[model samples]
Target chain A: MSQDHSLNLKNSHEDPAKATMEGKNKFLGLWFFLGGETVLFASFFATYLSLRESTAGGPTSQELFGLELVFIMTVLLLTSSLTSVYAIYHMKNNNFKKMQLWFGITALLGIAFLACEIYEFAHYIIEYEFTFRSSAFGSAFYTLVGFHGGHVVFGLSWLISLMVRNAKRGLSLYNAPKYNTFAIYWHFIDVVWVFIFTVVYLMGMVS
Target chain B: MTDNTNINKINSYENTRRKEEMKHQVITFVLMIAFTLIAFLVVAAELSRTFVIPFILLLAVVQVGFQFYYFMHMKDKGHEIISSLIFGGIWIAAVTVLTFTTIIWW
Candidate 1:
């Protein structure tokens, strides 16, 4: 094989995402970033936990959170996570078109999840008068969940950019790592949501 | 001819292994959805607060475990450093949560 084994179809490895040094670095770097991201979210969760009951004079978590909506949002995001896995799966098989198609599905689910979130927030502010400034509970609730929403927004932008920028290029070692990195980050966002729905919504309903 | 045959064999073998891995991922996704349903059902059923809280949190933890280890392939080879970093983050997360829950309550 030539020096650029990654460019040689016959010499290419099964996973272009980790076939080169840059790809490996991108993989490791994303995980390292996620480790830090975990701590960042944990702090927000701690704050929310400490102040979740301080409603002062406004609506509380139980009254504000609807199980039906949260369940739908959870399914959307969780399915998006699976779709991303499908994208990565295709990437490994060198099936660029299928990878893009699955990633497109992942983005659609994310957008749907964000739409539900925006609707939830509007319902709170309109129906319950539960603005972020209303109480400690309100502030914590908005900050925690809003932060997650903000991540989804950012992730959507990231995914869209990656898709658009690489649309003409197809799959190559140069860009495979980038897509893989975004998939991992997307999965981590879902991991955060798992904790949020459990601790914030379900626990709030319990008590 | 020999080189072409060799590459073809490796590609087929890798494709089979990857297909097997994908089966596991789909299975994990199904299990995660089931866990989410159970958590929601238990909470919606209005069970004892103390029991339900811990139980749902346990389910969340298990689901996340499946996400990381199965879907993210953290259990795959060459992930030792990544594992250490993730577990370290978890340690910090635990301490942070504990501190806020215990020390800052009003």
Candidate 2:
């Protein structure tokens, strides 16, 4: 079924991702899902902002967040975002191998980012006694940042699955949209992170 | 056949345009990185809170705009409805954040 249009569109269209009816629908539908996700994250952010000061004698964001670690995490995620852009670039250029290679780089960077997050959370729990039940601030912080981490884990899984499933198929209209959709999702992750660093970490240090 | 030659011509032309688009995206990425550095530095420099907070927030907004327009391809054709959907979400997000922050001011 996938190859039905393979002959007609393998190298013909500028963006194979949107060349077909299904691909167009998938692209639009993914954006719609992301729009809803924006609201979902907004709610978490609001909760975090309102309750951030209710530390209940526990450690505060000022005490807990280190600029160095967050800075490193930001670079890793931002570089990964660019790498996914490269992957999509190659995808559009109809170079399957290069596309996979860039996505592989993207995945590696994502893993590194995840590793840094795990280290951060563990340091908090073991060193500072900042558990979710510590106070309102703890709960809000964990929910907002932890939810973002959960998204990273989910995105990694999604990328790996798509790569492995299509390892042998190369570029086809059927799967191009899937890869493009992943890129969109990955960029949204970076967008959320920009806000997190600004509102949570940087502002936490400011005041 | 003549059609074969025509297809090659169009593909090459499109490839050129895509390459130019890639160039712009790379430029966007560089500017975004610069913005991130400025944000961190301003906070690290221990500036006055009155100015620092809003300045950094504005930088964040600009960087996010680059990401949305360049990386997400919202600047490309056929994204009108997608643009509306995103702006709508942002509208709700702003309202919700305002309500929560004001409600719990203590």
Across B43-84, the per-residue lDDT of candidate 1 in tens digits comes to: 889988878988999999999999999988899999999999
For model 2, what is the alpha-carbon lDDT of residue A2?
51
Candidates in order, TM-scores: namely 0.98, 0.97
Error of 2 at A71 (Å): 0.6
Count of backbone collisions in candidate 1: 0
Q: B14 in model 1: Cα distance from truth in Å?
A: 0.6
Docking class of 1: high
Q: Give the poorly placed runs of model 2, Cα more than 4 Å off.
A: A1-8
Q: Please identify model 1 stretches exceeding 4 Å from their true place.
A: A8-10
CA lDDT, candidate 2, residue B101 = 97
Place model 2 in a CAPRI quality band.
medium
In the order shown, the candidates' DockQ scores are 0.86, 0.78
Predicted model with the maximum TM-score: 1
DockQ (0 to 1) for model 1: 0.86
